[model samples]
Target: MTIDGSHAEGLGEVEFDDEKHAEDRQFVRALARGLEILRCFQPQEPLLGNRELAHRTGLPKPTVSRLTHTLVAMGLLEFLPNHEKYRLRSSVLALGYAAAATSGIVELARPIMQRVVDEHGGSFALGVRDRLSMICLIHCHSKAIFTLRMDVGSHVPMLPSAMGRGFLVGLPDHERQFLVDRLARVSRRGGQTTQEIVQRAIDEFKAQGFCASYGEWLHDILSIGAPVISHDRQVVLGLTYSAFSYATARATMNEVMGPQVRQVAAVIGDEITRLRWRP
Candidate 1:
């Protein structure tokens, strides 16, 4: 869904609608709005006033004020009297750490990801879908002077990034279609339509084992990614290898990095399955 006035400020907004969930008894509108407020803060733009949060969330300023107050009370946000803004607190970090530690995927994938970057001289990352974007869960980088400026918790657009495309191809058909439709409704970068971009990725994944983004997401970076799915097919994750275009040619990405990422993804999927089966 398109958020009114959100594009004018060039800030990413959370995609949510109370009307969509109004009929569902399990859906809590207040809780969802509160979470959306929290999502408005990015790693680069952490401090946000209530007015900014309202604009990003497309919620009323009064409603945002209430939610921010509640979040501060809950220790998830801290209000700065001097700056008159809110920032994520240690509680949020603790919760995030707890979730990551329990997932077991980060621990399982780190070594393999590190080995790939160490050998290939690039960056390797694992990410999962977070609403309309993919949030990095783990990252490994080579000992190079220059590398991609992204870390764990960084967000990337789903339509343009190889990691996001890899995750999209892993979804069931109907589910993928739902997200594609949503993406089409929002403003997209580059010349290609959202459907065209997504369809190309789907087709590429079918023809090859992995999806590739040759400077589509970032003008100077090249990335190749593949999906890692749980044995039960419930959880889907994306694994990616990225490097500067000058350092790695597109032919090399198509031939070497693509297959390597695909193999690493398969290994991660098997590891996740083993973890699930452990007593």
Candidate 2:
């Protein structure tokens, strides 16, 4: 395939070892770095300078510069001529939407998730595991408070939040143990220890068949999440319903929302099983 200026721009990375990169077909680390650079442009910080991008992404300045230039050329990032800042372009959504269409969970869960959002008066989010995190697939917003700042392509860590814990609870003991060990080695962003975090998550998920988090990923937001398992009992999707405050969450659960989330998870699982997705 020919690599165009757009392709180079889309690469959005510079600090790569050619030999190491060639050794792996996935090149996951590079892909992550590139995506990180792109994601630095948010609704609030719509435009950012090279230094800002580097700070947000933890990529070196030279790497950020090269990546931004490439993205600008690719039409994914628009360079503000006089302002010397970069902003995301509409083309970025193409990649996200294409991925969603091809994903079985997104295709299967859309309607059911929408119903959950309608009944719950909150937001329903569907995600699938990608490497060490879950990438959001679909989000149906019912209230402004529950509406996610995250779009379809945002990645949530597999360690900190309820969505992550929901998936963890579905794993077999051996697999869970491995993840627990891995979690121990990772640094905590907040005050909790990794073991304490994982154990608490596992305990809650085991008890409730779902897990909830308050101010884990974002302050003032409360999220309740469950996992959608395939017929063979492998987790394929992580589902979440979230609200802005405790009062909002309490109201949602007391009304129709909590039951709807549970029901939707079961419906999604059944649909995937009917389609016979083994994994």
Candidate 3:
């Protein structure tokens, strides 16, 4: 699969590469289509109709209808007679929870991340790349009244957010290039080219061991992030510390929180290695 573009909520347009899998005898197009249909649902938009699902997945309405019916029958989606739309059911959440439970990283990092939030006055998060976005796997916040409200499962734009940049820099060279090429196709925002923005992130990471975003992802948010990689280089995640821009200064993030978050990321990586958590 490849990402074509993204919605305002950072859900990427999932495009199945037919030509690449055409010669594979084990490829199941129907199964792929069904999963793609499930992926169409996002946190910001819980209810979706066949027309919207068709648009998001680039599938025919008839196929979407069949898939939705099958998904409803399988208890993955709930049909609403009042609105002629479907909402994700408990089964989907169950699946996500089961997948998350298999990973020890969240459990291992929870106390450590919470301690940061306890000492500092911001939010700390761990995220993984999901297409052209970063999906929060874990989040902790301070008691501040104005802390960022994002929690687990929140999606942030990959090309703009500090967390996303941290994840991007953790990827292998070929994988990073592939994603950058796809991101280049997205429309420019803030009058900055994608390459230019990504280059700045790379340079910042190289110079300071962390990436910083000041009023870039959101006009009122300031953040610093670092990448976490497993010992074998198979698992990559992003760690971030963020606060409202009005409460935090850019220089503080660059000089203090940047290195602090970088150290946290390294500690999490070491814990993952010690525990031998492969997931």
Candidate 4:
């Protein structure tokens, strides 16, 4: 992932299919195909027919039909009568909601996130990497008039998102390299895929304590984030402070918002440490 300039870079992932893991007896092809079918439905393009599902998931039509039928019967997907398409049902939402509701990070970070929102006038996001996407667990939309439409469960591109960069930088060295290699493979940014380009952002994180992206994910958007490290669980929570580029310059966000977010993240990490390691 490469964010423009010294600011940073990235977005990327791959899934393991049954064939890849078929040697293991526990590998379930049906379950994998069913889940893959669900993931094919994008939030932007919510409705898709069986053929489209088959095309997107690379599963055969018959397999997709069977999976969709099972999913619809299970209430995880809804069949559209007129369109002959299927949309993910609220049951799918329940899965993400349940996870977010149960997360100790959201519980501990909400107040500070709100404070960041109030002060910064942009948005504060607490997220974790799911493959090459940063799945926002908590998004504190600022009270300021200027705000981005985002909330819990929003998926931001990993390489381009500040939260993603912070998460990448926060990863253990070998783990970071492994993920970076994955990003390199999936990257389609016209030959901008190189470890050297991404290393600048990591160097920035080492020097500034936060990583940033200026117009990498979305045009005219700027974000700075740091990783929340818990002393006990080896947890690295990705948190971001972000806004439109017109109002908050890259350097300003890096110098000011970065530190503020890092501090708030530290508080959350401390709380987690206290909760998990309390004697």
User: 1 or 4, which is superior by TM-score?
Assistant: 1
User: Using lDDT as the measure, which candidate wins?
Assistant: 3
Q: What's each prediction's TM-score?
A: 0.90, 0.70, 0.93, 0.87
Instruction: Identify the candidate with maximal TM-score.
Output: 3
Provide the overall lDDT of each model, using Cα atoms, as 2-decimal numbers. 0.82, 0.67, 0.83, 0.75
Off by over 4 Å in 4: 1-14, 277-279
Q: Count backbone overlaps in model 2.
A: 1
Residue 11, candidate 3: how far off, in angstroms? 2.5
lDDT by residue (1-279, candidate 3, tens digit) is 111123243355687866788999999988988999888777767789999998888889999999999999999999999999999999898888888887777789989999988988889888888888888888888887778867567677888888888988888889988888888887467687777877788889999999888878776888888899888888888888898888888888888888789889999999988898765
A best-first ranking of the candidates according to their TM-score comes to: 3, 1, 4, 2
State candidate 1's TM-score.
0.90
Writing each residue's lDDT as its tens digit, candidate 1 over 1-279 gives 111222221236566887888799999889989889888877767799998888878899999999999999999999999999999999887877888888777778899989988898889888888878888899899888887746577777777788898999899999999988888777457688888888888899999988888877677889888889888888798778899998888998999888888889999888888787221
- Alpha carbon lDDT at 109, candidate 2: 78
Better of 1 and 2 by lDDT: 1
Tell me the spans in candidate 1 whose CA falls farther than 4 Å from its real position: 1-16, 21-28, 277-279
Span of ten consecutive residues with least summed lDDT in model 4? 1-10
For model 3, what is the alpha-carbon lDDT of residue 54?
Answer: 89
lDDT of 2 by residue, 1-279 (tens): 110122111112223344666777777876666778876553334678998888766678998888888888888898998999988888986776666677566667777777666665667787776545666677777654435545666566777566677777677778777767765665445677767777787776667566777767666677877778776775567788777675475555524454566677788888888887533
**lDDT of model 1 at position 172:** 93
Alpha-carbon runs more than 4 Å astray in model 2: 1-46, 52-60, 102-104, 130-133, 143-150, 155-158, 172-191, 215-219, 233-235, 244-259, 276-279
- Cα RMSD, each candidate: 4.4, 7.7, 3.6, 4.5
Model 2: residue 254 alpha-carbon error in angstroms:
9.0
